[model samples]
Target: MYENCLKGHSALVTGSARRLGRAVALELARAGADVIIHCNSSKAEAEAVKKEAIALGVDATVLSADFSVDGGAEGLIEAAFEVAPDLNLLVNSASVFPSNRLAEVTLGDINSNVLVNAWAPFVLSRSFAARAKSGSIVNMLDSRITDFDHSHAAYHMSKHMLALLTRLSAMEFAPSVAVNGVAPGLVLPPVDMDAKGGAADAQYLAGMASGLPLKKHGEPEDVAKAVLFLLASSFITGQIIYVDGGRHIRGGE
Candidate 1:
């Protein structure tokens, strides 16, 4: 709702091709910031988002990166810097949500979860700090990190690691880069559910919302608003704003 709040800033938002990442990038663009959109395999989708951002009267571009590959995060940072030479904001939003219980989790699952969710964000944060005069980072996290999710053992663990990095990086990058996170809960449909009309998924979400204190789910825009707040704040750091519709206050997930 703020106007031209980020007039002089530029941002690179990973996974900006769709969903929550797209929302965050657009939110920043609406606030008057040039955006560098990043996606791994969604070039066409990313281009669409870039057009929308450009329509907001801000410079926008797209970059592709595979965070699961070696040196991928570094390559993303380098390529982004080449485009936005004065980049001052980073949104680490690219993530994979694979469902696997503890006994069912494979080494491949663990590595992928850690690489994309935690390791990639850390690498980008470090790289951003080394070059920026002043910046802010908003890591997309899960509210499940506060309690636990047995259904996604590896994914939960990786998000827990990301939450810790949010705090630690704020300290390490002190006075230069402010690190924060936005923990979302029951926001959007999962990838598999997105393509087809998810009647069953809608029913599941309706049932799940009953357990939450607010008795409702959230939207991608809610998480975007949280990211925008952290980006605009100069005094807030090392904190996570849970945009979970009060679900996090429940005893356990």
Candidate 2:
């Protein structure tokens, strides 16, 4: 909505290869921000998104890092600064969601989920604060943080950790960097739910949305708009905008 509001900013959006991350990167580019798209192994997809962002009339590039590894987050931040030293915006949009109930969740599952979903974002945020003089950070969170997702116990725990990090980081980075989050519910189906060589079933998604208070699911644009809104503002900090069509209010499983 705020056209060219981020004209001079440079952004690094993790997991920008596809889905919501792709939407956020393109949206930022539309607002005139130079974008660096990051992906774990989807360099091809990231390159395509880069083309889209460049077509938006802003400088764009692609970077890759494995958040599952030890130095991945730190390395990614270093790489981002190498490309855009004036970088000022960071969006922690990459995450891994595993489907395992609490009773069935293994230590390995917890370790992997937390590494990518929580630990990496923390490392990235810390690295960003240390390098940038002033900027904004938005961590993508799940609306399910307020409730239990019995089928995604590991993922749920990781998001809750991230939610805490968002608030604490805001206070820590205050008066210089604004730290906030966007919690989305049912905006897109989980990657694991996708059928072989196809997207997730539309009918299944529609059925899922019927339980939400709005009785409908949201689009990527809805979440992107929230991210842009947070990035455009200098006053708002430590707040989480829910783009979940009020599903968070119901605290569904």
Candidate 3:
């Protein structure tokens, strides 16, 4: 579907060393965009992704930035522009997914989550919008922002703010650039669960999928395709596409 729409375009995908971020970066490269893959610590994985992108016949580079600290977002964007001076697309896919009940959440947890999940995206979007000749931005959000995930209060609240940032940046950027978001549900479990070989987590996700209107769990590819649509649709902006197996309509699961 992308075809030559993204040919010669340059994109930056934050937290792109692995998981959904890596998936999105590779998809963009396959669609003909040169990619800059940013990671905080996964240098080896980032290089592997870079090789994959290069195999697609597009320029690919890896950059590392710790978005939890001050000036990290600016440095990431700067590094992207250094790789491709005419950068035109940015995906704010890096985030902190900390699960904690309200009573147990510490101030440090709240600050770190907000800084990485909400503040980094907003700051990066603002920086890109300011200097972009003509570009589009897509923010990665969670479906839980619409419904509450009690155990993940801090993460959900930060994403809720990010959803708002997506809309506001769309308006703020205006005719020069477009801003949008993709709110995904159950595409992949949290990294911790994935690491533990947690069959129960998989079962729970499958059960949730059965409840969805689509009767299936989504994959990163679903969100990637939606992102390509937004990037190509010149008339669309300030929109949030829920690639969540219609779970948003069901209110959860």
Candidate 4:
């Protein structure tokens, strides 16, 4: 269904090295968008994703920047424009998820989390609005932002900030650019987990999924598809699609 939906469009997907970001990049390529794959320290993996997108017949290249560093977001945007001047789409998917409770979280933890997770996206969105004559942006958010995540306090706070930015940006960049977000629930395993999906982590995720309305989990492509839907639409703006299997609304029950 996504075939050629984004013809003539060019996108820069942050964190495209692996996981959900990788999935979104591939899906965009399948839909016929030239893509710029951004990675921090995953250049090798990003190269692989670039190859995959090129194999799909889309112009693909890899850009690297550490979002945790100052000016990283701005630098990446400048570099992307240098590579794809017609670039009109931005996917702010790169984020840091350091686990710590609010009571125990350090100031450094808060700074790092907010800088990478929230500030970076904010900068990218601003840069895109200024450069891209017209296009759209998809910010990757978390379903947990609707509530609290005591176990990941700083990360949760940053996501809340990003959610607010999504709405404000949609309003700020309206008519010229559409800004939206996708909040995914139990999709892929945590980045810290074993790449091969260990049994213990599988059981843990299963237990978590059992309580969701869907009583199951989702895949990275599920979130990627929702992103593509937003990117392909002309009327959607300032909206957050919960690709969370009803987890965000579970409290209502």
Which model scores highest in TM-score? 2
Name the 10 consecutive residues with the lowest summed lDDT in model 4.
192-201
Model 1 residue pairs with clashes: none
TM-score of each: 0.96, 0.97, 0.95, 0.96
Give the runs in model 4 whose Cα sits over 4 Å from its true position: 194-201
For each of the candidates, give the backbone clash count: 0, 0, 0, 0
Residue-level lDDT tens digits of model 1 in 7-44 = 98999999999989999999999999999999999999
lDDT of 3 by residue, 151-194 (tens): 88788778888999999999989999999999888788676554
Per-residue lDDT tens digits for candidate 2, residues 1-253, read 6899999999999999999999999999999999999999999999999999999999999999999988999999999999999999999999998799999989999999999999999999999998899999999998998878889999999999999999999999888999999999887777788544324456666888999989998989899999999999989999999999888899886
* Model 3, global lDDT: 0.87
Q: Is candidate 1 or candidate 2 better by lDDT?
A: 2
Per lDDT, the best of the predicted structures is: 2
Q: Tell me which of candidates 1 and 3 scores higher on lDDT.
A: 1
Give per-model CA RMSD.
1.5, 1.4, 1.6, 1.7
What's model 1's lDDT at 38? 97
